[model samples]
Target chain A: MEKTLTLPSHITTEKLKDLYKQMWLIRYFDEKVDQFFAKGMIHGTTHLCVGQEASAAGAIAALQDKDKITSTHRGHGHCIAKGAETDRMMAELFGRETGYCKGKGGSMHIADLEKGNLGANGIVGGGIPLAVGAALTSKMKKEGYVVLCFFGDGASNEGSFHESLNLASVWDLPVVFVCENNQYGMSGPVKEMVNIENIAERAGSYGIPGKAVDGNDMVEIINTVYDAVENARSGNGPSLIEMKTYRWKGHSKSDAKKYRTREEEKEWREKDPIQRFKEVLIEEDILTEEQAKNLQEEAKQEIDDAVKFAENSPEPSTDTLLEDVYA
Target chain B: MREITYLEAVREAMSQEMRKNDDVFILGEDIGVYGGAFGVTRGMIEEFGPERIRNTPISEAAIAGGAVGAALTGMRPILELQFSDFITIAMDQIVNQAAKLRYMYGGKGSVPMVLRTPAGSGTGAAAQHSQSLEAWVAHIPGLKVVQPSTAYDAKGLLKAAIDDENPVIFYEHKLLYKTKGDVPEEQYSIPIGKADIKREGKDVTVVATSIMVHKALEAAEELEKEGIDVEVIDPRTLVPLDEETIVNSVKKTGRLIVVHEAVKRGGFGGEIASVIAESEAFDYLDSPIKRLGGLPIPIPYNPNLEKAAVPQVPDIIDAVKETVRFK
Candidate 1:
């Protein structure tokens, strides 16, 4: 492991360690999903956020329990970072009755309202407008809460992105639009789809603050989200934040990934957020090498327990198909 | 009971709902200051202020998605799509996100929001502005579709829709805005999925919706002189579909005629027909269920052509007569 370091004044070492643990949890959860899927345990398809763990962990770390988040199809990371239980999420993926959605929504629709996660959307850019609405609610009720909306580079090109940004800006709603620009939208590269070099620049049209940050850098993402959240809660209006990152896995379980080169993948892996953060924790003496190893083992154990819980859970009742369709 | 225009009744329901509940608010294009495209919300901004009565950009997806988000956060948001045809722009939000969120999330959250829009053709607005796309929303598993034919039903149903736990697509016919009818001054809510028997007769049942309800009723009145007693039924809400009322009505009359202004192909009329066919009513029928809907063609700008595209009072009269004459 390489050595590197730094921390803000108020943030304790324990919190940083927790954030590291969260990133690891996201990584392991997605890996487990991939394995289970290959073995035909999980039905349907899933979009995994493997290499983008830092963005989810860092951004969510800046939010309060009262604040809300809207996630994309690749949302396991966001759900975990926002405090969704691993057992329920895993059960959902496994199509068990104990799943977050009672097995109705596989991986793409998991949500924990108590944790302030609105839900994950399967359609690209589908959750952007929803965040704006949540912000509208918070603003109207004078609730000091900000909504963090997660979408991708491909979704930024969707018309909903432009419409949502404009509405959020014009209404001065309390929201932070976080664009996880993971280099590709399905098989197409970001460069080919977007005209502007950065998705943040498009926010200029909406007259809101817009900027880009290193998504893989946990500390950087946390700081950016902190500032955006503050601005939103203080009624300064919405902001557009672009987190430039890369996803190591394919867009979904079935993707052939014929678009990107292996060399590019190798480069991104070298800058893996988890490994990078692990090095910082050790170098700064926040955790010893032994402690770091123990934390990884702890995460593995948690995941194991979650898998067992999901496997042991029963399937949804066949007679209950018509229930919950209305209420 | 006092007479009021359909437009006034719509405004009254929203105003009453907002006055009763602080969480209820309105958001859409030109809804705040401009009072919407048809002046339905003209005085609302002054009373509720810009905060509660918000004016959004011309973005249908944002209007819809934001409503879903706000509803998830415990707010009752009413989104206006300007015209029902514009619903196509926000289909992903309405069909995928809002419709699936509750069931997919294991019923942990409910989107108690109403999406209101003017539908049907007759004013020469042509294709983009004048299509009745209720069937598109009704086809979705998790959405409730409602259409009110009169001023009384409009106010009552609007109130009901605002209070519904699920997302509702409320279609208000454009031509019916100025139409007048007896409405109660006291606040009341009609059950969402119940069918109202506008007129009772034993010869045949005319199950019509929205503007078609008016046409069906008029046809019934004309057919009375010819000894063809037609029973006109308005299925105020389509999704939950008062199947019992429809089936019972068909059984009593021994003949059924389904009418709507939407294109005939794949319209909600087909769904109603299938429901009757699969029920005990199929054996009691004196004649096959007659499905009457608009022609499967884009509504043209010319007044004559626009009128020709959809079923008018004459067509309803003819269809009712044919059904009564079948056996």
Candidate 2:
């Protein structure tokens, strides 16, 4: 068993409880998304982040209200973790009128700027530069904020990632570049796709500190990001964090997922982060077995309510075609 | 009063705006210590320092993305694309992000920024460097497109663009940079969406923008000699089009010729023609609405080919002749 290290100030009992609830919510939300897509209720492909709940919840655990995040295609978890409404996100996935983007932007493009989620972009490295820019703005305006940019191992090859890291470092902008090494980029495993041993090692070229963490371990994720966030808030510039996580499901809803063996999925499933967290909470006497069951049930009920809200929500008016173009 | 060229006019606009607002800053390739390729932002680095007068790497997408992100976070960013031809590289940020953000947020946010780039064909810079692509931006609903034909309009319009709650694409013809005009020193502004009737006439309405505005004025002089009075209307800003002025002029003369440097097919000229056709002006037309535009060919390496790719004085002359008709 990999024993993940934790910080003294990190993962308070209250915080862990909140993380458990959010983790359960995202798990239920992603599961419902899979069902909805299969039933033809949701349009377009969704990269479900079901088993990778700990990565999203733990990474965003210590983010301030003013902090910003840029997410990837598998971004619903990131949005929900950052406090975006489940109903609006589901509505956006449904291409409904009441969506965050009023159906103009579907699943991959869902965003709530007020909540500091810059939206999940269709392009792999599209949002990378934006995170750097937002951090640059924070630095220049003395806004005392940080920007966390999340991308897959595949995006490590993009010129934007390199260029953005360079710019952020040169300007000493408050940015945390997190590479969610989910072991695969649409069937191409991270091992096969990247030449580097770890994506975090790429940060050395930009003269920024880099580290690899157990992405599935909430304690590790919280501790690693806690230091990175603190350094940025104190004007120490950016950090490159590589989280070695695994995805239990296929890349998208339409994926046959025949590329990987069922045995491999079962092995990763046995090491599920949600189950591990639950076990940890019980072992530490932070949460009883009944409390965990009640939390999961609550999350399921909340997701059900969000689905009803999305189904009854009206579609955006056609007049939106001409609005929000420029302000 | 100061004797300044069109290039100087742009520099004055940028310097003045930066001085007036702490949020205002400039970013582009070779625009800081090296000055702009066309010298539009010369001396800006010295006046405002490298932080504000930022010289970015040769990355158009990054420039546009930076502007979009910075603007969203309450900073007014002014982006300069060394040349208009490279705009295609950043069309995603310009068209999808900056133009759509304000309206996408239900007008709750404004991208109060400017993208000033040197355009038009004449310095023999050839295809890859020389282009008058203002029409492309004008087609976008949320963007404000402006081409200042004189130093006075350049200074005034830039001030207005900086203060505007929308993204403004301010284009200065490459050749127009050295042309001088007597502009008042006191504070002034040219409204973003208004059209100025450069030379009023009764025979025909010659609606020209950017460099063509000057060509139309020259063409008007030649037409006057032939007893054909021409009204050359300079639509300073294209998106918030001054349709009222254009429609009124078309109604008065019963003839119209829409001229632009951009290639004809689906160009901004089509939009103007469509607007006139849809309005009451269609009933007052003495001839078909004529549009004189660039030849439908890629700008070539040869100076003459580049020159032929866009509308010139002769093209405007021919359009006016055809539309006015020989009574």
Candidate 3:
């Protein structure tokens, strides 16, 4: 393992271990979900962020409890990073009454408002404007909190992304846009889809600061997002930080991934964010190899328990189908 | 009681709400100093200041999405889309995000926002600027769609919409903005999902929405002189439609005619007609349920063409007369 590691003042050894554990949690959770989906246990399609865990973990870990985040469709990592319990999430995927959305939302729309997780949107660029609106509330009410908006590279090309960025910039709202630039957007390569090399560069159009970083590097993600969050908290305005990462899994359950080559997948898999973070933790003496194994075992056990809970949970009653449509 | 224009009534509702609640604010393109395209928000920026009465760019998606985000974070956002026709640009945010957030989140979160837009033709603003797309939003389960036809209904219903813990689409007809009606100076809120009987009769029932309400009333007057008594029912809100009032009215009159400014094809009139057909009112039919709506073409810029595209007083009068004369 490489020993060349520099830690920020806010990131202690314990925090590093916690983040490493969270990355593992996201990995185990999604991997289990993928397996369950194959067996027809989890209904509907799911977009897994198997290799892009660091971007969600690092960026979300930098914010306080009062801060909020709006996530994308492939947002299981974001939900976990923002403190959602795996059992409830699993129950939601199971279409049980105990699920986060009472079996109404399914996997695409899990949200925990009390945890500052506004919710994961099914639409590509749907959550962008909501983040700006949340920041607007923070600014108008003089609430000293910031909002971090998580979107995919594909969403950057959406009109909502441009409109949201412009509105956030003009209003000087406290928001940080974190774009997880996973190579492909539903099998469409980012390079072919966009004219620009970096999605972050588009932030300049709104007169806001933009940065692109190695999304696989957890330290780099935390540092970049921390600065952006502080900037927004202090009323300096919004910033767009594009995290260059890749998704190891296919876009959704039914994707054959015929659009990309196997060599490309192998290359990205080699740069797995969780594996890289675990190696760093061991090298920095934050986590020993034995402890790391135990952490992985604990995550597996938690997932097993979540599956049990989901199986035991009741299906949503027919009587409540019309409920929750209004307040 | 004081006579106020529908535009003034809307503005008053927002201003009063903002004054009463610190969390209430307004945002939209040209809504601040420009006072909006139809001047519904004129003189508002001065009263609430820029923070509360915000001016946004030409970004309807952001305006709507941002309002959802703000509303999620304990703020009541009143979003104005310059024109109802432009809702197409922000459909994903409004339909996919704002309309479904609460239900998708299992009732854990709510979007307490009001989307105000000017709808209907007669301004010669052409296809892009003039349209009555209320049916599109009313189709969504989680959204509350209101089309107030008078100054009194506009103020009261808007206040109720702003206070409701759900996303409300408030449709203000462009032609009705300058029309005056009696409104109380003191703040009041009309309950949503309630139908108002604009006029009472027994020979036939006329269910009209927005600008069509006036036309229906005028038609009722003209039909009265011809020995045809028409009962005009204004469905203030579309989603939680006052089915009982409409059903009872149809049951009493034994005749029904649904009218709206939107195209007759797939318009909200279909929903009203279905509601009547589904209820016990179906047994009390004197004639086939009649529906008068806009022609199934884009609104034309020519004054005469625009007038011809939608239902006018003569159309309503003719429909009522025919229904009453039916064996």
Candidate 4:
């Protein structure tokens, strides 16, 4: 494996190592969710964020405990990175009362406000503007916090994405628009869907700076997002940063992905973010191979526990449907 | 009290709310220096500056979605949609996120957000801009839909909506924007889900919303000349429907007519009828519940046809007459 990028020695290796572990945990949890789905142990659909872990972890690393985040459909990584309980997320997908949303929201709507994960959204381009609002709130409340919004390339084509960026720029909302451009938007390649060479370039229209980054390289993702987050917290308004990444799984389990060739899938697999991060940790001497293996095993065990908890949890009573549909 | 148009009243309500509360802010398209398309916010940018009276790009979803985020973070966001017909673009944010957020999270948080949009027909706004879709929002349980017929109710209800802890979809009739009424200078709030008795009669109860309420009042005057007394109940809020007021009126009059500017199919009027039919009031009825609303087709552009398609004074009179004659 190639040696991944790293910051100067002034930055703590421990921080980078911890980020690697968080990414690993999310990667493992996502794979477990996939397994549970295949075994019919989980209800609803799963949109795993496998190759896109670095972007989630990188942005989340810059956030304080009180900083907020809004996530899109492929949101497992974001939720996990933001500190949502794995067991609760699994229970939500299983439609259990013990779930984060009391079974009203499935895999696509896990949230933990205390942990600063505003929520996951089932709608494409749904959460972007909300995050901007959150950032605006932080600014208005004088909380000095920032909001990180994670959306896919498909959402970039949505009018909401453009609207949010422009509003954020105009109002100087404390928000960072992190576009996880994973090459394909449900089999429609980003290259074909948008004319711009990079999704970040579109931000220029709003008179805000935009940048593209190696989403698979954890250190690079962190460095870019950290700049944007700092700028936003300092009242510099919002910036759009597009992370060029990939998704190792289909859009959803029902998606056979007949539109693309296996060669394309195999090509993206070569740049798997999870594996790249691990190799970086090992090469930088931040973690030995043995420590990495133990961490992987530990992640696996935690995911197993989460699955067990979800399976044992009770389904929500029919009466609950009437209760939570309204506030 | 100062002389104000309906559009001017709405602007006053919003500007006053924003000025009074640090949390209250306005976000919409061309809402800043350009005012609004209808001139509702004509002078807000000059007073509040761009910070509070923010302008956004053309994304209805973003307007709503950002409002959702801001509301979640404790800033009471007042979002303005230029046209009600365009709400479909942000249906998920309005219905799924803003509406359901408070309840889904087990009441841990509330979406104290208000969406102000102009609805109903009569301006040559054509099919896309003139359709009255309040019933769609009222159908959702999490949403509290309010349509005030007069400037007094508009200001009072808009203030109440801003103070409300849940998501409220506040609708204004495009046709009603020019209509004005007496309003108090002192701060006051009208409760949501409460019906106002516009007129009292022993013969029949005319339950109406938005512009239809005025039509019902006008019809009541005409019906009085014919020796027929008509009671008018304005259901200012639709979702948390004022069932008691409606049922009591139906029981008293033994006849009921429900009216609205929206299309007949699944119009909020149906819900009131259903409540009356399913209640003990059904036995009190000397006649079946009559519903009068817009036709089940696109709102036409021609002034004559457009006015003909929706509920009017004549239609209200006809419906009240039909209900009174029913066995």
Give me the candidate number with maximum TM-score. 3
Using TM-score, rank the candidates from best to worst. 3, 1, 2, 4
Candidate 4 residue-wise lDDT, A166-280, digit = tens: 8788778888899999888898988789998998998899989999999888778777887888888888888999999888888887788887888988998898887887877
Per-residue accuracy of model 1 over B1-327 as CA lDDT, tens digit each: 699999999999999989999999998889877889999999999999988898887888888898988998989999988998888888988998889887888877889999999999998888899998898898899899899999999999999999899899999999999999999988999999899999998999999999988889889889999999999999999978999999999999989999999999999999999999999999999998899998989999999999999999999888887777775
Question: Per-residue CA lDDT of candidate 4, range B199-277, in tens?
Answer: 9999998898888888888999999999899999998888678899988998999998888888888887888899999
Candidate 3 lDDT, B132-197, residue by residue in tens: 888889889889999999999999999999999999999998889899999999999999999999
**DockQ comparisons of all candidates to the true complex:** 0.84, 0.46, 0.88, 0.61
Model 2, B220-321: lDDT tens digits are 999889999999898887878899999999999999898888878878888888989999999999888888888887677677777778888988888888
Clashes by residue pair, model 1: none
What are the TM values for chain B, all candidates?
Answer: 0.98, 0.95, 0.98, 0.97
DockQ of 3: 0.88
The lowest-lDDT stretch of 10 consecutive residues in candidate 4 chain A is A2-11
DockQ order of candidates, top first: 3, 1, 4, 2
Decide which is better by DockQ, 1 or 2: 1
Query: Which of the CAPRI classes, incorrect, acceptable, medium or high, describes model 3?
Result: high
> Runs in model 4 with CA error above 4 Å?
A1-11, B1-12, B33-35, B103-106
Query: Which 10-residue window in model 4 chain B sums to the lowest lDDT?
Result: B100-109
Off by over 4 Å in 2: A1-5, A8-10, A95-98, A317-321, B1-3, B103-108
